[model samples]
Target: MTINVPGRFEVGTTVVRRHVWGGKVWSAMPYRVLEDVGDYLTVASWPGLRGLVSTTWIKAFLDDGHGRDQTIQELASGTWRLGWWAWQGTTVRSWYGLDAYFTVRQYFDADRRPLSWYVDFDLPKQRTRMGIDTFDLLLDLVAEPDLSRIQWKDVEEYEHGRRLGLIDDRAHQGVLAAREEVVGLIESRQGPFAHDWSPLPLEGWRTPVLPVDVRSGAVSSGLWIS
Candidate 1:
C-alpha cells in the first residue's frame, strides 16, 4: 500500500481526535505526538489527558437488559450528552496510519511497564486540522506483550452494532479485513511489535490540553485554537 505521509505534527505537538460518525463528533481525545514518520504516526496519552465522551453512548454499554434497545434509540436520535473524560488508566501509546484500517496501542502499567497490546479496528484515518478523524468499528483484538496469547474483544458489541445498523456493510467489510491484518502483524512480529517497547522519556512533558469547544460537537476544523 502506497500510503502518503500527511503534513507532519512535530514531536510533542498536542493533537486531538475527532471521533466522527454521521458527520458529527461522537467523541474526542487529546494526545501528544511522539513520532511522525513514514506511513505511521505515533501518539501518546497519560493519566491527565482530558477527553470528550458521550454519556448516551456509555448508557448503551451499561444497560444490559435494554442495551440493544438503547443503542437503537441512540442511533435514531443521534443525540449525545457530551462531557469531560479524565484519563484514568496507565499511559497509552497508539500507532496510527492514515491509510490503515486499524490502530495498535500499547498499554503501560502504573509503573510504566508494558501491559499489553490492543488493536482497535476502525475506519481509515484522515488527517484533520485538529488532528485526525476516525471512527471505531466496535471490534478489537487484544494480545499479551510477548504476543503469546491473543483474544478478540467487544465481539458482542460489534455484532449488536451491526444488527442495529450502526456499522454499515462497507464498514463491516473493512473490519473483517482489518482483523486478518492484525493477526498477520502479530504472527510476523511486524508493525509495532517490530520496534523497541522501551518507555519514552516523558519526564518533562505536561498533559495535553483539550479543545475549548468540546461540547459544541463541531468536528473537523477549528477544534484547536493554538
Candidate 2:
C-alpha cells in the first residue's frame, strides 16, 4: 500500500503495536498524518490524542511495582484488558519506515521547541486497513534534540525481556541489526536526522480517537509489509 499524496495531509488513523509472539495488541495510538511519501510516513500526536493500551502498561509504567518482567509476562500472556490512554506533557511526532526495524520520534515542548529524538527499536512496520502494525522490542535509543549524542535506553528491560524469552533469537538478532541501522542514520545525518529540527505544523487539527475495532477488541484488519 503506497501512500502518494500531493502534499502532507491530516490522516485519521491509528498505529497499533502488537506482541511479536501471539499477535496480541499492546497499544493502538491514534495519529495525525503529516507526510506520506513512498516508504516513509510521518505522524503527529499531541496532548489530547486518545488511544488504547493494555492495563499492564497503566499499572507497570504509570503506577508502580509491576516491573519489567511482570509487564512482559502479562503482555505475552495475551489476556490483559484494554484501557484508554491519553498523551500528556509534550507533542510527539513519529517517523515510520515501512520496512525498517525502528521508528524515529522528535519531542516538542509547550512552546513547540524541539526537545529530543527518541528511537524506538521494534519490528518493521506493516500497513493495515485500520492503520500500521508493529512490535515493540522494549529497547530504545535516544539522541539530543539536535539528533546528536545518541545513547541506548532501557537496556535492562530489554535484556530482561530476552531472558524471559519474549524477545526470541530471531527478534534479538533483528534488534541488533536495527541498532546498526539506526546508528548509521545518526552518524551520517541521514533520514529524519538530516531534516530540520522543527516539528510538522499541526494547527487546527483535532486529536484522533482510537479505531472502533481496537476499542472493541476485535482482531486487527489485514496487514501487509512493503
Candidate 3:
C-alpha cells in the first residue's frame, strides 16, 4: 500500500500558533517554524511534549485571502522518537508522543486582516503519554522594532496527572493571560502582535536539511538546533 507522505519543508523560517482546540473557548499551540514546502512544513520545540518530533508530522496552514481567521481541523496524525536526559547524565531514547492531527484554518489580525495561514497537528487516537509546555513572546516594535523576544516555560502534565486534576486551572489561566498581555502590549505600541500556545516549543529549536539519497531513501546529514 502506498502511504501519503508530506513533502519536505523549506529552511530558516517558522510558523507560530497553527493549532487551536475547543469550540468557543479555544486553546492553541504555536510552533517554531523549522522548514516549509509548498504544501507541508516542519517544526521543532525545545523540551518538547515527548521531547521531540519527526519531520513528517508537521503541516502548514492553508491561507485563504479572506478576512476571517483560519482554524485547524485534524485529518491525520504521525509520531516521533525522542531522547531525553534522565538522572546523572543518563539519556533515554523512546517513542515520544510527537504527532499532528490534520487541520484547516486561516490566519488573521485583530483588525481582521487576512494573513493567509492555517495549521494542523498529526496526533494519534489512543491517549499517548505527553507533557504540557507554555511559551511566551514579547514584541517591542518601538525600540529595535524589528526584533521579537521569547521565553519558554516547560510544565510536565501526564495523562494520569490531568485525569487526577493535577493540571490546575491557574496554569491554564496564566497562559491565556500571557497571550493577552503580549497582544495588548503590541496594540498599545501601535504594532501588530501574534500570540500562540502549544504542547510544542514555539522557538529555540532548529532542524537542518541535508542532501537526500533517493537510492537509499535516507538523508545524508542534517543539523539540529537546540
lDDT of each: 0.76, 0.72, 0.25
Local accuracy of candidate 3 as per-residue lDDT tens digits, 109-145: 3333433322221221111011112111111112122
Candidate 1 on 1-226: residue-level lDDT in tens? 1122356788888877777666677788988888888477899988987787777655654575356456445644677666667777699999997678799999998899999999988778777656777777778899998999999987887887788667777777778888888899899998777877889768898888876764344543311211
Ranking by lDDT: 1, 2, 3
How many steric overlaps does candidate 2 have?
A: 0
Best by TM-score: 1
Which candidate, 1 or 3, would have the higher lDDT against the true structure? 1
Q: How far in Å is the alpha carbon of 156 misplaced in model 1? A: 1.6
- Which candidate, 1 or 3, would have the higher TM-score against the true structure? 1
Candidate 2: tens digits of C-alpha lDDT, residues 71-133: 778765666777878889899888988678788998989888998899998777666555567
What candidate 3 gets wrong by more than 4 Å, as runs, is: 1-166, 189-226
* Backbone steric clashes in candidate 1, count: 0
List TM-score per model, in order. 0.86, 0.85, 0.21
Most lDDT-accurate candidate: 1
Model 3 residue 102 CA deviation in Å: 22
